[model samples]
Target: MDAAVNTPVVVDSNDDGTVTQELELEKMGSTLEEAIVETCSMPLENRPRLPRITLSKRNRAVVKALSRMLIIFLEASRDLCETDLILFGTAMAVCRIIGAKFSTAGRTTAQSSAIPAWGIIIEERIATKMDGGGR
Candidate 1:
């Protein structure tokens, strides 16, 4: 092994003294939230040519809460492997690149039942990708 590889070095730091990995991760999460909000706020004609998804207002709140819970789980629990974090973060960025908002905020329920949360959806996607790319 190289001496440099064995050496302990501070990878991320600053004079502000706020440069820990978790702090950076938290900043990333906030940026994600901002991105989601911004993309959701955009007009349809201005959005990309791919699928532009929308959800009812209440569903939007629920999805946001579920994703926040997923983030909490990813950080709070040590169960996830390093690669899993990459998948989760990329999934988030893509969909923050993958935002959602109802073109018209709904006055009624999106559905009568609560099932298949965003975390579950993400889990399924990850599993499929890890399992070699088929639905």
Candidate 2:
């Protein structure tokens, strides 16, 4: 939908200062709003945060690498129309998002049926809730 989006979810820390999360996702065809509502309706204790990663300092580098891969794929597939390129890009983004949502210790690929639009909204809701910026 939009060019940029962000979503965040914060899991309250336990007595040991660890956050545990149990995300519940609906089937692929469901609306993004519905997915967000479901995620929000869950109990706060289920949204615990995993331990911070020392290699997290390289997060930006990882993103840059992925972006470069997208660019390379686009360049290599130039015979395809602009629409195809756009769709491919969106697909990559969607995959990235799914990975973020289900990932426990490392990145994971999301099924293509999960629309990017819904992913954006989910991310926004998570960010808002985590940051205490919900409307």
Candidate 3:
């Protein structure tokens, strides 16, 4: 293969029976060439794209609450495996990344509640929105 300029080749076919060939060779590094060939040779169907997330606010709040619960479970419970901590850390990271905020602006009736009542309230609000206020 002869090294040609870095221009994308266009192969045009005629309606009438005629054969035309255009090949462009690129001067790429050994690793890059290998990578390109490997990537190109792979079946397009097998190369899946990332899935989109369409999370509702209630879902976000639930996820956040679950993360908090997991953290609590990890902290309060004894004899947790190293893997549990890893999972908990990952969940915490995700909750923070989504930026699920809980309203702590006002003192609630259950302000002295020990079981993260604020987080629960936020989660309820989120759940309500997700459910279209069904309840």
Candidate 4:
């Protein structure tokens, strides 16, 4: 999308009683809804599937932090692209990795490996999306 084409106009009154017109430049890109739909329509094998585990206090904290970071990034940026989606997925993968490491601290190596495995799957899916050559 052309950023210049989608610039927003703003009008302001000066102290001298004169009006000024300004162009607020913004990045032009797809909407969040469109991005979500594109993400959801990905093949099952190319999607992240985090296991259903009870959220511990630490896990909850990590989730909250990651969510806030994602919201901030989304709000501050104008364009939403596949790379952004991949970054978001990577953040989610990191959260899973942290949860898996903490939750499995006392478990067997095999059991503790589950979360990391899921994280790897999610990373692979993101990589596939990145290289699949489509938006």
Candidate 2 deviant stretches above 4 angstroms: 1-56, 79-99, 102-135
Q: Which residue pairs in model 2 clash with each other?
A: 7-123, 7-124, 7-127, 8-126, 8-127, 11-47, 19-48, 19-49, 20-48
lDDT tens digits, residues 1-135, model 2? 122122222234443322223231121112233333333444433432223333332333333333443453456554645435344343334333333332323222356534588898898899999999885
* Candidates arranged by TM-score, highest first: 4, 1, 2, 3
Window of ten residues with lowest summed lDDT in model 1: 1-10
Model 4, which residues run further than 4 Å from truth? Answer: 1-45, 76-91, 99-135
lDDT score, candidate 4? 0.41
Give all TM-scores, in the order shown. Answer: 0.25, 0.22, 0.20, 0.30
Question: Candidate 3's residue-wise lDDT over 1-135, tens digit each?
Answer: 122212222223442322122222122122223323333444433432222334754334334433443453346545644334434333323332333332223233454464587888888899999999945
Please report, in order, the local distance difference test score of every candidate based on alpha carbons.
0.41, 0.37, 0.37, 0.41
Q: What TM-score would you give candidate 3 relative to the actual structure? A: 0.20
Clashing pairs in 1: 95-98
Candidate 4 lDDT, tens digit per residue, 19-43?
1232121111122233344444554
**Candidate 1 Cα misplacement greater than 4 A, ranges:** 1-20, 48-135
Candidate 2: C-alpha lDDT: 0.37
Report the C-alpha displacement of residue 12, candidate 2, in angstroms. 30
